[model samples]
Target: MPFLQDPPRLTNAYLADPLLRELVARALPGALGEVEPELEHLGELAAGRLFAQQAVERLLEPRIEHWDAWGRRVDHIELTPLWREAATLAARHGLVATAYERRHGPASRVHQLALVHVLEPSLDVYACPLAMTDGAARALLDAGNAALVERALPRLTSREPARMWTSGQWMTERIGGSDVSLTETVARRDGDDWRLFGTKWFSSATTAEMALALARPEGAPAGSRGLALFYLETRNEDGTTNGVLVNRLKDKLGTRKLPTAELTLDGARAVPVAGLSGGVRAIAPMLTVTRTWNAVAAVAGMQRALALARDYARRRAAFGAPLAEKPLHADTLAGLEAEREGAFLLAFRAAALLGASEAGVASDAEQLALRAVTPLAKLTTGKQAVAIASEALECFGGAGYVEDTGLPRLLRDAQVLPIWEGTTNVLALDVLRALAGEGVGEALAAEVNAHLAAARDPALRPAIEAARAALARAEAWLAAAAGPAREAGARRLALTLGRTLELALLAAHAQWCLDHGRGPRALAAARRLARHGIDLVAEEPGAEELELLTGPSADGGAR
Candidate 1:
């Protein structure tokens, strides 16, 4: 086998698949062709792992000599050829290529939840680089920041234990993790010399050298706007203390090993990222990429959970027959499949948005859509994946609850996803603004109309009609909505309207492309996904009303 860390610097082969080709052609034309190679690499990694059960059985290296509480030796998983290749190449390229894909491609649902329900908004810790804790935040982002990120990315692809690329997101305080606005950490400016001070509770200052810290600038506002981002690189030449202190680590329900560090900054000097007022907004963008990955990870965990349930159902007999033969069990499997597929399509569409931004050609409408959808992607996907895993575990009956079965870890991992990035409530708020303001409503309606028009499958005709009706419902809602009342009404309408429309659009995209024959595997998968996606959206079915109704006096929408 090749000594590489991941698939070769190749485009994803699936993009060439019939279904994916079709989807790409419809969703993105030239752009679709461009992602082919990258997607192929993703496919290779997935296929290789799927082919070698051992590759996936243990996601991390088990070679290290350690023991769980039960004395179970930590298992060291051998790196797959593709994984190795990816890692090695990432090191050479000074960046982790498709690190997001690595986690998301396999477990999209779980990844979605982490960012949506927990990670993004929770001051419980972990800061997005886009937040207010980096110096020269904008300057660094141009080239230097990208370099550091790229340089550290490959280490993550390797089988090493500690996560790489995630430098520091300081959120502890002498008071408490909550109410960060009361944080006392200070960044004193002395003759161009910036030094950090004050003790932070659960600072985690000891874990990694680099940190995006929030510090008070002597006399400043009392709220969050008074913060700044400092790039505190690990300066300890010998991998030792670097003018920072880690008081202790906290034991938590799920992410126990991830290290909840308590820290102390002792007159530590750091590079200033940007103006103090811009910290929150600056670092907020960083969550954009990572949150997406969290959502992807959630999906991975769910898939693992499903695989476990599927395996058990096929092998274990409950009443003189395999559980798979039972109707209820069969229905459960179908539901899981439906949920998993839906999560995949949603997450993939979000990824496409990221791809567009990277290409430096994203439109205003698309960007706004991305902003709205990313959170939705995180929240909905996370909740679904976690719920699916629970169902799968339930399918296993008694055996699933056992820690030794490994099924439990998937659930635990999934549990952390929604709580990692931004909470569902926060997402709900963000989406409300997106749909109510900006060109989101009109753009979304037009997109929906187009989506319905693209479908060739007669099976979806009724659903398409219903979806149009729903769009009409949404359109009517938007037509009459205004002021604070609009926002309140927009929230509920936004979710179903956005999701239903995007799903239909994505379906039509896949349908048109597959029939036309463009990209291959990616398009083929898109088509498969489109059919399923349309079906899923059809579940909520919408149809345009002939006369159209108005007002916020209706069920969760404009009356």
Candidate 2:
């Protein structure tokens, strides 16, 4: 045989990740014994059979069957073999039910998200529907509508494959993307029920059993306040479309396996989630839940990419020696690994806070910290995922770019993390809005300091000081800036806070590892991340200078 390089193979997602194992063990010492078996099993499936199946299977996108032979319109979507199988696996694994089961109490969220981290990357974004399903379940429970809660909550949280249900969040329309205040979808009273009439421009998971949407009531006031959140089944009792017209499936850049559609709702029957108004406020719970999923999924993607790249480095030889033996190559992988560790801790911390809040075990300061950390984690990890994935691709040389090797999908899928749920700019503004609440800034500072206080290692002192200094600079900038200046620097300020917190959390974990005789790997990670720099705030440019740089020039020529 010719001298050919052996391809990389995954042994076990759960076993391969020491960071995940240690974090869970430290955070949920009491629950690790309970959740370990399931986590280990899912990790095997994700790396073994699922990985092999995806490698050999023909890549297929979802297709719609518009009409039958008799001219009867049937908007049926056929999913790929993996997607269909994913639904069953996800249900049996209790990927969405684990949090609601509360078997581990407040730590249940950590357990649930831990399973999601291992399983999502292998399922080809099947996490899309599961995220919405988890969000809808939380939103419905919070709404407290007796009938809908009774009818939907069980199926949504069910572990049985046959009984489990997924939901679509149909909020985007022709008029608005993130700004739901301009919604034009209208609702008309139909006795006790309501009928919705409008177009949803971007509806993901359209094949879902049901959906939560927003629409303006007839003669109601304008803007988001006029809108009401409503729940509707996608199909009627006869298994026909419930006045919903699936116009067409989107030709997306990534996540092609997912069924995203542009929909026209012609009087689709719906019931109010809470009441006829305040839909924007009512959907807050759903946003918080889904945004956390986004952050977790982002970190998971980064992990997958780095794992493959690291394995490849160990296997491939260049210039008569393995790439892993080369100092520069090893250094590159270390940088990527450090970024991944920071991202993983930041995202999991959000999950921990959420679980504590829901279990009613969190203190007042913790509750306020959760409000700010949710958006920070989402935006920060989302950006990190794209950057890490792109760099990981370069580590593979030419093989990474080849589609047949299945490496390119890592970058393509990661590109969606920053765009979905909410874009970077939009989420940065959300962070500012969170700070507007009473004691939110102080609470966030308290949370960061708590993490920094955990470190006792002398070697980790520099990283701790760097984190504290970066946080102080961010606070000072916020106090000095006002109006347009504050808004203009929102992204830098948000990133500064987010990265500062990540460094602090990593320092604490590194200290834990040192105390437990787990060696200096985590301490090395904290040091590297500090060297990468946490502070992102910069001096704001003058209005005229900014306008000149961004706007059209007076000569109407290219700047």
On TM-score, the candidate that comes out on top is 2
For 95-116, candidate 1 gives per-residue lDDT tens digits of 2223234333422222222222
- The weakest ten consecutive residues by lDDT in model 1 span 116-125
Query: What would you estimate as the lDDT of candidate 1?
Result: 0.52
Where's the lowest-lDDT run of ten residues in candidate 2?
550-559
Clashing pairs in 2: none
Model 2 lDDT tens row, 1-559: 8757778878799989999899789877987777788889989999999888777763778999999889999988999889999999989989999999998889889999999999998998999899999999999998999999999999999999999999999999998999999998999998987999999999988999999999999999998889999999999999989989999999987888889999999999999999999998878899899999999999999999998888888999999899999999999999989989999999999999999999999999999999999999999999999999999999989888889988888898899899888999999999998898899999999999999999988999999999999999998998888989889999999999999999999999999999998889999999999999989895557888778778867556945
Residue 365's C-alpha lDDT in candidate 1? 71
Best by lDDT: 2
Clash count, predicted structure 2: 0
Q: What TM-score, computed on C-alpha atoms, does each candidate reach?
A: 0.67, 0.98
TM-score of 1: 0.67
Provide the lDDT at 229 for model 1. 63
